[model samples]
Target chain A: MKASDEERRNDAVIIRTEGLTKHYVLGAETVRAVRQIDLTIERGEFVAIMGPSGSGKSTFMNMIGCLDTPTAGKYWLNGQLVSDLSDDQLARVRNREIGFVFQTFNLLPRATALHNVELPLIYAGVGSKERRRRAEEKLELVGLADRMDHKPPEMSGGQRQRVAVARALVNEPALLLADEPTGNLDSVTSEEIMAQMETLNENGQTIVLVTHEHDIAAHARRQVHLKDGLVEQDFLNEPVETSA
Target chain B: MLLFEIVMVAMGAVRANVLRSVLTTLGIVIGIAAVITMVALGEGAQQRVQEEINRMGTTILTIRPGQQMWGGVSRGDAQLSVEDAIALRAGSDGLLKVSPEQQSRMQVTYGRYNSNTQIMGVWPEYFEMYDHQLEAGRFFDQGEVQGRRRVAVLGYNVPETLGGTPPELLVGSTVQIRGIIFEVVGILEEKGDAAWIRPDDQIFIPQSTAQYRVMGGRDRLNSIYASTETPEELDQAFAAIDGIMRREHRIRVGEDADFNIRNSADLLETRNEANQTFALLLAGIAAISLIVGGIGIMNIMLVSVTERTREIGVRKALGATKRAIMTQFLVEALFLCTLGGLLGVAAGYGASELVTRMAEWDTSVAPEAVFTAIGFSAAVGLFFGLWPARRAAMLDPIDALRYE
Candidate 1:
């Protein structure tokens, strides 16, 4: 194949979901948390999935992050189908391909920032010297290189969020999945974190961010808004430069 | 990145909860120490009993008559005669001493002092046979028996009844047995009683003198004391004497015997059996504590799993495999157990020493007990550790991540 054709062929289509659904039985009631949905994402695409509370945005993010299996659907990542993967296989895929940023910045509380960032590499069987080098580089990238030895509890909310971002990017995963990444931060810290995420995306990283705010979703080129477990709209945002 | 990361995490977890880990380990330590100390007690008791039995000496046998039958129809009386004693000594290959004894209670008198005591008629060799030694004066001699002399040897206690005078001073002094004046020849040393009579409180006279003057020349004798050259020939001596007595009395094989023979070997065997029983009991009690310690490990591990639920979720969400989670918990459990086990071994040694000092008893703590105690504690850890590790591994990452 030609190099451009091969680049397109191997362009890291990270998430492809068809008829994805999640149903849970509580007592006698069967609740469908996420209805049938089809979605596709390509290499280096910065996309935002927006939904209000109980709109199935979190459930969809979990499936896309390989933390949960779809009840009935075909989900593929990097040309490999993931819908039928076992728990162990899913864990391997999650470690190698997807990095997650939770709303609460889920870094281990008692662990140092370096240890937290080294976690993915440790799980991926990376050697210690290389794990340390990569972890340090990622922390430097997130502008927290001097705080590598500090624990999560020792850092501020903004600093902790940045450490979590460094951890997410350490493995050089194909996609970064952030679920309400700035929900717990103050407005200024939230803006700072959003700017960091923007810088990461500009450096040729794919990002699928889940958020409820329109302003947060507007930071990305493409936005998909969900209402009541169904996609309400899918459109590109107007260019920020033209609007200014 | 590999299994070592989980091990390091476990180490970090233990380090963070140092007090809790130490307390948990203490439970196992106590369990192991209890088991070890109890076993040591049993072993010490066994050794003490055996030593006590051995201190009584060997090669000494006691014979008593068989029970009387209805209408006296048994093989006459079981009375051991002087004739039988003499025949036993002459026929036995390694016989060192043989004496027939007759006992009777009577008033013994010296001047104004009078005391009722058991009188024993023993041959000259009886002094060395039962390890009896002279404090003052000498035991009766062969010439006294040949002449049928009325000479008595006072045991150490009998001198107290005679106003505490030396036996030599009392030697030519007259002591009347049943109103007959008998010259005191020797005094025995203060050897305490066996199972029955006190040797120091008894009075000894020549067999011939007691036979003729004391017992009125009756043909029947009460019992016999026989001593072999050494312990090795004791059984042979017993068999030889039994054979001579039976033949002299014209008793055939399979006929009812006239006497019963008892030896120190029987007492020794009984002491050994009791020791074995004690050891078994101690081991059983120790095992109970070990089981209890194991349950404690299980309880603590369960609590740890609950406490670390969020950590597990975060790791799982970060792509940690279930095997990694399981190994983390298992290593933690093992570490706790091994630490407790080592401390327990030290505790056992100290406990044994304390017991030995406080009670004045012998307590020997063997190396095997230390190793076994530690191994048992670790096994307990492994056995109880599995459930909590599995519980942590089986956690659903989605539910765990959302758990408060």
Candidate 2:
């Protein structure tokens, strides 16, 4: 049966969070890392969550990425109630719906760029041929096709980040969650990597990045600034001024 | 991706850490070699003993006229006689060959050189029936036995002591036995010593000469050597001999017979039992080395798990399952053990050969030992590897990724 535009629009509500909160105990005192907050993310949305250090951005990102559970709230990803799932089920959710990119470009040091890209596909149970094919295509999209066999150490910082990006896209997940995706790279390399990510987001890939740099956050269509573990500002980016 | 891929990944991991892996497997190699070589040595020694016993003649019915002591059979008096031998041989049904031997300590003098040696009086057929080969003149004829000729056949040691004299000269020469001159007629082949008798130091003479001329005792004979037609007839032959001797000696059925019958098969059995015990002891010692090898594997695996904490974290973060992580490390451990087992098998063969050549030990590496070592090493890999593999698998991905 062909789905109508209304059904497709309703499917836009890919990830939803209601009063999500996380608390941790340090010695005898409880530290509320993520205060109660409500958030919703739609499919094909490019979102940037900007925050200062220790502002609970990482905690919220972890919960949203399914790497952690919210202490006092519910999180639903792809219509599944994720906060109530077992560890294994949560891991499956992360594998199927959430692709994470760390600031350090956490590609396995000894593994080839291609192998790094194939990791998510490996967990998704893609056969060897399909995994290789899809990983090659992803690396090609990230403009790292010629460097597919290079290990992380052999590649430049920008190249390594691109490989990480390719790995994040390999599973075709609902959200690409990047934590300071270019934090360690030089300005030129960081801009080059950000351009590739912008291209991906323009092609309808949903991306969520945590960053402190306004220049890097400018690539996203929507920005959510957080301070003191609460949302301080939310805004939309104007259309790219091609004629300027 | 799959189990096979995971195993391949593990193998690649071991290959990357070649030196560490080899060092871990060294213990197993030594253990396998020790077990195989030690067991082979024990088995070889036992076979030598059994061969010695078998070559000493068969179906030996020893008639000792002593009484039993506290749970032990004492050496009886030499009350056996030629008449007893004749009676048993003539009356037995399955009798093929029988010889009553008398042994006495005497001085053998050839020219001016005199040596103390055992002088044995054996029948004419005793030499040939016992696998004895003559390196010189023929044995005494029937005429010489019936005539009670004073003749002696020198054993290997006696002849050597005589300055390697030619067999013909020794045959015709007169050797004084107990101050009486006895002509040498035949020289028996070199038969090595049994557990009790050193044949090379003994001289053989006719039973007539030993009993009537030299011993001057008519009623006593030493132990008798007998053989049936075939090994299968030994029991029947022994029964017939025992029955005849019992009847002739007038021993009633209720009384214990005046002899004990010892068979070559029994000697072989004893030797086999000793060999089995020796083999077990050797295997036990070797197994300790294998355990040591297993410990080495465990130790190295423990270190590897710690060192690869970051890598494990990355894999976990990348969606590798706990089972996949566990299987990867376990396969690496198994691979290490298998390498050790292969090298140990080669080392065992080399060691066995070295022992055979250098120490003159009879060493034969058994195929069973190879298979056993391989299996044991694999078991050790699995057994000792589990804890480390589990540790790798159970690590928290977040904490592991954070490990410096």
Candidate 3:
């Protein structure tokens, strides 16, 4: 079967890196947080970066999410070279191309769920009406439509994480980056978030998750383990079945 | 649209910390209130001085007796007589309208009611010089002054003080001044107070009547008033008066005369200058308070930025540019100051009203003062809000996100 042009574009690689490295100077000692890591994440793929303490998984995730620039490396997101982009340009890249789900949920406590979801759109200069419509649609998609007006403090851990997922998806970014997203949740809530992420991956959303939990990493179709600032192993895995 | 969102975000942040925000704005409020109230009082005092200058006749010069010296030794007193006034009137080439005045406090009675009143003796021209209007009867003419007629023009309140008789009824009636009977020819209208002079409470009569009949034939006059039609002619009138007075007093040329010619307008202008200086000094002090208030805003804004560091990190991660973050905080500071300015203006207006009611002082709140007060407060916000906003904008997203 011949795929259409849009399908071919969708099949293209979403992220490519060559010798991505990051170093932090702590007084006199130089700490190499991420070193000589080469990785690629294709469209419609779910990948988990797993590591223990003192590993470089978090630093790698930060560089991939466009929150930090690699000290020495070439990196591209959706075929655009973004390794040396200025701070403001990188912010734009993060806004348009990457959606971040931090471990802390990172939702503004004072804003409603709907408002939290609408934040990226507001930064994108969307009109209020259209922004509200898209935010509502995303919240509904995450099964939080009835709790749209609820604040983060008023919601459960699972519900707040779902709101974070909704916010991450609201901009329709090319890649979703979740860093220890289930770290603060109980096992049941973590399972629920992982199922939701699996559902999103099944629907052709590219995702890169960072976690130290083996079971959480097991949910991804591929796993890359990092040790001491280098990739120790990279392999594929059979996706875990979702009960929902 | 983005700007609007940012402004709303700033407003939400302020609303979240209601007590802190209110306490932060208190400094600006008191500062602006002090500025407004002080300026209002200064402007009010200036206006009053201007009114006094206008009322006292700007073109009029009063010639008072000065100490006469013989080789720098003091003479007990020098005199200005009716002749000096007549000489000024005749020799000024019709440039001056002159009147000699002699006043004494005396008891006046009418219909068994008596009151202590100020009795002023002068020419008919005195009424015109002071812009005195009559409520009833006619002013005694020059003929009455030459004839030493026992006719008087009562001031507006004289009738009320003398047993509450009406002005029109008092005119054409006989009243005794120092037990001497005089006919009331006219009643002057209410003139209000002008500086130290209260024209509304004195009784005016012919100069001859005062000198020969009431003042025990005293020939020494108190002072002579000379006026020019226009302010431009005042200098010429002054020179003429100086020459004429020197000749009348028989003093030599280039020697100091035994009299001083003071332009009433100049005296009032000096007083006005002093009033303005005092007002400006007060306004300056008030402006210092505004600066101190601005410093307080800056301090609070710094604390707010530090407290919201994590929020700033989240916003930056969500695609907020440095300019956007800067604008958000700046708008917050500006909003707080503008709000304080408005409230301060209200409080200041109330304070000025209170002063007017309690102290009986005339206070005019100029519209310009209101506008300037608000504008200055906004500027204060902008000036003081810059550093905190810059610090917020310069924050590293990763560090901020990691801040505990």
True contacts kept of each: 0.78, 0.27, 0.69
DockQ of each: 0.60, 0.40, 0.65
Top-scoring candidate (lDDT)? 3
Report the lDDT tens digits of candidate 1 across residue range A1-244. 4863444345466677778898878999987888888887887788999988988888888889999998887787877788899999999999998898988888899999999999989988899999999999999988998999999999999999998899899888889999888889998888888888888888888999999988788788789887777778888888674121
Candidate maximizing TM-score: 3
Provide the overall lDDT of each model, using Cα atoms, as 2-decimal numbers: 0.82, 0.79, 0.90
lDDT of 2 by residue, B55-147 (tens): 666545445454433224654542566777778667775365777888889877788788888989888766756767777777786677789
Off by over 4 Å in 3: A1-11, A238-244, B63-84, B109-113, B147-150, B163-183, B208-222, B230-285
**Against the true structure, what is model 2's DockQ?**
0.40
Better of 1 and 2 by TM-score: 2
Score candidate 3 by DockQ: 0.65
Give the DockQ ranking, best first: 3, 1, 2
TM-score of chain B taken alone, every candidate: 0.68, 0.80, 0.87
Give me candidate 3's interface root-mean-square deviation. Answer: 0.8
Model 1: colliding residue pairs: A122-B1
What i-RMS does every model get?
Answer: 1.2, 1.8, 0.8
